[model samples]
Target chain A: MHFPISDVTINPIYLICLGFFVGILGGFFGVGGSFLAGPALFAFGVPMNFVVGTDLIHIVGKSIVAARKHWTLGNIDLRLALIMVAGTIAGIQVGVSGIEALKKINRVDWVVGLIAIVVYTSISFFVAWEGWRTSKLPALKSKGKTEDQSAVSKDKMAFRKFTRWIQRIPLHPRVSLPHSGIKSISVWAILGVSFIGGAFSSFLGGGAGYIRMPCMVYLLGIPTHIAVGTDLFEIVVSASVGSFQHALHGNVDILIALIMQTGAAIGAQIGATLTQYFTGPRIRLAFAPLPLLGAGLIIYGLITGHHTR
Target chain B: MSRSRDIKSFLIDLAVYGVLVVAYFILVLQFFGGWLTDLFHNHRLGYAIVAIMLMVTQAAGLEVIAHFVLKLVRPKKP
Candidate 1:
């Protein structure tokens, strides 16, 4: 297949299979799947710019499929998603401009790549460690048995208490999320977390869901399913904006995105539906290795300076 | 009877997914083929509008597909 926009000749079947594999992970974990797709596209000889833009274009479509499925399962927190969008928009502007400034300094490629490697590596280790700790705890009852099994455990109680303390910070406008069972949290705190997520996403050229999903659970005390749903919802909006911006810059390869999305659409639905059968800890545990895989790719890219253009 | 219902639901899911894939391809060809390029060449705002339209349509279309699939797969009353 020849992608006109990127002017790359590649196998369409490869992209479709990659999209299906990543779509399943993204749908289940609520990440943009770009962590996998971006490197794979680059390795397939797509330019770095095209990989980022085309991945975002596909992610917008894939997230919609996954998020809609999650919405039907009563997992989405619309209010949280909407609020996060505001912060993300602002953060993306700053991040993009920051990249442009770095470009003028003639070190945008290596700088951003190095930063991504460091951040992804650190976060992957943290997630893996936390997942390991969580898995060591006693197993919960099987799915569909009872809601009581979903309650916070002793080890998690301190983290929940910390979130409660932060939620009590006397901000002017506090909001309650009934769907996620969050009593009250400061609006500013939510924006702060989302802003960081968006900044990292735009700066690193991946969907911020990998960052945001963990924060929503560990920081804001949201349930795993809700975090996943809300993260996908936000990714749909953020990735769309990113795709538009990349299109304006002539970076998006629409043909590639379209081909990939054809597979992702179906895969996403399957992955989202499968999540209903797993417990929260199990899902988080399953998600831990994804970031590690992404970090390994970034580290490889940084070491080899491959596709650093 | 239950086996027959399960088979019917599985068939419905396959059919709906096929429909979704076909609809998505048609929409992509219609909007993205030359229409988007012409719009971008002529006017910047028009290009953005078309892009937004594409996003909105894709989102709505996927949601509709999901809704129909869910409805078809839902268990029937005894």
Candidate 2:
């Protein structure tokens, strides 16, 4: 039961090196850090709770770097970022509360595991489906299009309807922003997503970007680049708030986080720089499996009675 | 734009190290020693789990501190 530093301590140099690699992958794909870091740490004998908390911090750092990089590229959609933050915060609150409730029944892990599995798998399906659908389209194939434009058009009609449903409600000052070309938003949708994100983040210790980003990009029809940039902005606020909350409750381990962050800080920069060389699909192809594999690892660990103790 | 980014990046990196070092020291004083010992005395699995978790928490704080510092750090090279 005694986890002396000697028992579980990984070489700081190795962790830093790993952090650098994760950072590069994160910058290239815009994820992979949280999704992979948690499981990787778990395998290394880290607890689940700490993994979540630290992952959030890692995300906060990476997002800051990523957002700034994107801003320089003229890729950020400020209006969307603002609205998403509104929803993202609300969602985190609900997520935290839900975990509190679930813990009472001693079923929090199961609930979190279920959500993780569902969200990760759904993402895998969507991305894989997109890849498949694109390959099947004749015009796109012949055009030598690196991407299937059809996916956008086909999804557009559905996304517009969804957005309209979201926009029908009145919850704001009717603020107009040129970035989104709208005077209003479905505050309800934003709130709904925020609530979902909050609960998922609190219980699972990671934001449901699998859900949030897709909702922003496909459901709300925000551009993908903006979605990445804005998501980072929202994470900076929400994850920090969440981390602070956990810290107040004495759930955060400051030392390990510090060391991890040291590496992450350097990693974030490397990631941001690498983003310039990689195309979106190439990045996705290279990095998409990390979370899926992480999810698999967790499930395997659980099913094999890794947590029975 | 690229040159500015590269310059800003180095500044961010420097700031990250500064913040993370400070945060980790605070954590070491607050919980690292006691928590590790408690895990040793009680349930080993629990202790290991906690240790892992704590490491993760430390990592998170480190990441945030790095981010904040990076933001404040000027792009002097640019």
Candidate 3:
């Protein structure tokens, strides 16, 4: 399909299939799946600016259902999510402004692509190491349940101790998230984490869950389930804010996003359902290379100007 | 056996959803493509509004329809 809005000719089928693939991954990992979506679009010859903004619009759609489901499951921390939205919106605005500034200099593509390569590579290696480290722990294996919060207290994520330090920071006007098992945490801590997540969201697209979800759990000490649910919820708001801002700048291609989302809507259900059958750490280990795959494609695209034939 | 049954039902759900998605996108998005592109270039805010509304409707609306239709077919599921 020729998407005149973005001035690209792509097979709608390819977009749909990509959405399905990423949808399953998102559903499986309980995330917005932009880690793949943005890079994949860029590799498919979409510009970086469009990839960033278009993916956010798509995420807003996907997360609506997932977030609603989590809300019903009592997995959401509404207070935390709402507060994070405030910080997230601010960060998203700043991030989009950065993209706009880059757009003026005609350096958006290579610079953003380089940043994505570094970030994706780092994430790939870190997840690989963490998944390997976590899987070898016999105590967690014996628990026979994924995301056992108590067991995760001693989990060897290398940054598990940082959560304690973050939670201990003495800031005023603290709030408790009883749902996520957080007690008396500074609001600033929550905002600081969310602000970073939002910046990532606007810069790279999707919900930025790949960064935020882990932060919510490890940095804030929220239970895994609650973090997933709450972060997904916040993705909707942040992505919407991102979409509107990006749309104003003509960085979004709605035609492409809508076509892609049709496939994601169903694939997300399948992905979420399939998760019941998989062991947790193994899934994480397998997922370790996906970001690398995306980064590889972006590299190929950068070198040759397009990975597609 | 029940697990297999569940997977089978899920596959059926996907097939049905696939058909629905193909039909809907071809009918709606394809028809409005040029017009949306015009709005995108000439009136961006309108394009953005339509884009967001279209996304939300497809997401919230179609999912409900999918589930409702699936329930009617598989009345025993509740």
For every model in order, the TM-score on chain A comes to: 0.81, 0.81, 0.92
Docking class of 3: medium
Q: State which candidate has the highest lDDT.
A: 3
Weakest 10 consecutive residues, lDDT, candidate 2 chain A? Answer: A300-309
DockQ of each: 0.35, 0.12, 0.78
What does candidate 1's lDDT look like per residue over A105-177, in tens digits?
A: 6555467656765776676677667666655554543443332243344434668777777778798699999
Question: Tens digit of lDDT per residue, candidate 2, span A1-309?
Answer: 222432355555655666666766665566646666665655555545545565665565556555666678877777666666677677666666665565456554466666666766666666665666655667654665455355566566668877766666676644444575555666566656656666566556755576677777666556666677767767767777676554433344444554555566566566766667666343454555667876786676456432201
Error of 1 at B71 (Å): 7.3
For model 2, state the Cα shift of residue A187 in Å: 2.4
Local error of candidate 1 at residue A228 (angstroms) = 3.7
- A188-300 per-residue lDDT for model 3 (tens digits): 99999999989988987878777887788778888888888888888888788889999989989998898888889778878989888885666778999998998998887
Better of 1 and 2 by lDDT: 1
- How far in Å is the alpha carbon of A20 misplaced in model 3? 1.1
Against the reference, the lDDT scores of all candidates come to: 0.70, 0.60, 0.83
Best TM-score among the predictions, by candidate number: 3
iRMSD per prediction, in order: 2.4, 8.4, 1.0
> Which structure among the candidates has the greatest DockQ?
3
How far residue A18's Cα lies from its native spot in candidate 1, in Å, is 1.5
